[model samples]
Target: MRTVLDFTPLYRSSVGFDRMLDLLDNASRVASVDNWPPYDIAKIGDADYRITMAVAGFAQDELTVTQEGNNLLVGGAKTGDDSGEYLHRGIAGRTFQRRFELADHVKVVDANLTNGLLTIDLKREIPEEMKPRQIEIGQASSPAQVSQIDQGQKAA
Candidate 1:
């Protein structure tokens, strides 16, 4: 016997969360788990993030970074170890797949592998038109309007 978890009910109940529901649906089928390569996700700034994975045994050529739709996929497959002549192969040199959920405007800037660490940078660009702007409040009176206010105050 198997248990099936239905999320459609919850998704329909959620308000102003259609995109999030879509993300959740996509994540449900995304490639994750079992292939758990140790990783760290850090928010570098208000709109910037960094994903660093400890891929020690994997080389730059072995690793691949790509974006499928709105998801970032980091995968690696160690190659050409056909002889299998390792007496003590403690290090993990097998294939791994990692998926990251990205926001609507988030994009992968770049990925680099150095000293066994694979670092992927992401940036969310809020457009000038979308960014919040401050409105300066000044005294609401032109020279003519100020005279009228002064006269009213004096009369009162």
Candidate 2:
């Protein structure tokens, strides 16, 4: 069973959350049956992430990884054909393209293809100005205290 959710009411009440709401809306509309070339995303440490995809029978040249803005695209295409005929073919070699939506400040650090597996590394690098910082507290003389000091000086 499939259910559709409406988010119009929340849209009118919130600010600075348009992207998050759009993501949620889009995810619900997308079909789950399009999943192919299985992949995994894991948060290995603070501000660090890893994505592993099973891309068997695909060469490094045939696969591509790209990141634009906050979106990541991974695609693979099989080129040429094997000469030998196979009576029983079980492996899949179809072309596939996968898209990943990344958060702000997240970047793709590296990607590697080995042993029919593709691994991508990502890190969220917050800007120095955006990071949380400590503010030093300083003492300030109140108006009443300053007046008291002035009166004491006058009496002296």
Candidate 3:
């Protein structure tokens, strides 16, 4: 049994949170998808993330990593021939495409393939204007206070 959450109420009362709602919906949808060429997502640093996928038989040329808008796409396609006679083939040579929805300021930093694993590094870079900043508070002087100071200065 699958339970669907209704976000109509949230949509009606919120603004600038559409992406968050969409991410929730996408997460629910991704739960039912097949886990092919298993992958792992880990956080290496405060704002750094890494995604490692097991691609035993895929070469660097056979894999592609691309980013479109707020989505990251990683795909692998076997280009070589499979005519070799194997008594028992255990390694999977199938093509796969995975999609990852990135948050607002997250970006792909680097990608490397080593030891039959494809690792993709990601980092979140918040702009200076978007980051939280402290504002200096200044003392406010009313007209009466200003007049009092002026009168005292004249007497002195």
Candidate 4:
């Protein structure tokens, strides 16, 4: 049985969370999709993440990784064909495409394939203008300085 959740109440109380809510809804809708070429997402540091996917029987040249806005796409396609017949085929080499939605400011840093495992590194880089800054408070001006400003105004 499939369960459905209502987000209307959440929307009524929260503000600036539309993207997160939409992502949750989309994940629920795609929950029944195929799980071919299993993958894992790990957090290495405060702002660093890694995604590893099992891509056995696929060559490095046959795989492609791309990023569009806040979305990351990984795809694989078999290059060579099977000319000989097999008595029992067990290995899977079918083409697949996976989509991952990333948070704001998150970017793809590097990607590598080793031992049939494809690893992708991601990092979140906050811009200088967007980073938190300290504000300096000013104290009241001295009475002498205020008086000098008034006298200068009268002379003018």
lDDT of each: 0.85, 0.93, 0.93, 0.94
Candidate 3 local lDDT, 14-130, one digit each (tens): 999998987887677655677998999999999999999999999999999999978999999999988989999899989899999888899999999999999999999999999
Give per-model TM-scores.
0.68, 0.82, 0.83, 0.84
* Model 2 residue 31 distance off true place after TM-score fit, in angstroms: 2.8
Q: Which 10-residue window of candidate 2 scores lowest in summed lDDT?
A: 27-36
Error of 2 at 44 (Å): 0.5
Candidate 1 Cα deviation (angstroms), residue 137: 13
Model 4 alpha-carbon drift over 4 Å, by segment? 139-156
Give the runs in model 1 whose Cα sits over 4 Å from its true position. Answer: 1-15, 24-32, 133-156
Return the clash pairs for model 2, or none: none
Query: What is the C-alpha local distance difference test score of candidate 2?
Result: 0.93
Worst 10 residues of 4 by lDDT: 25-34
Cα distance off (Å), candidate 4, residue 133: 1.2
Q: Itemize residue pairs with steric clashes in candidate 3.
A: none
Tens-digit per-residue lDDT, 1-156, candidate 1: 434456688866788787877666665764535646899999999989999999988888999999977789999998856686878877877898887878878999989999999999999987788889998999776899889989999999
Better of 1 and 4 by TM-score: 4
Ranking by TM-score: 4, 3, 2, 1
Model 3 alpha-carbon miss at residue 12, Å: 3.6
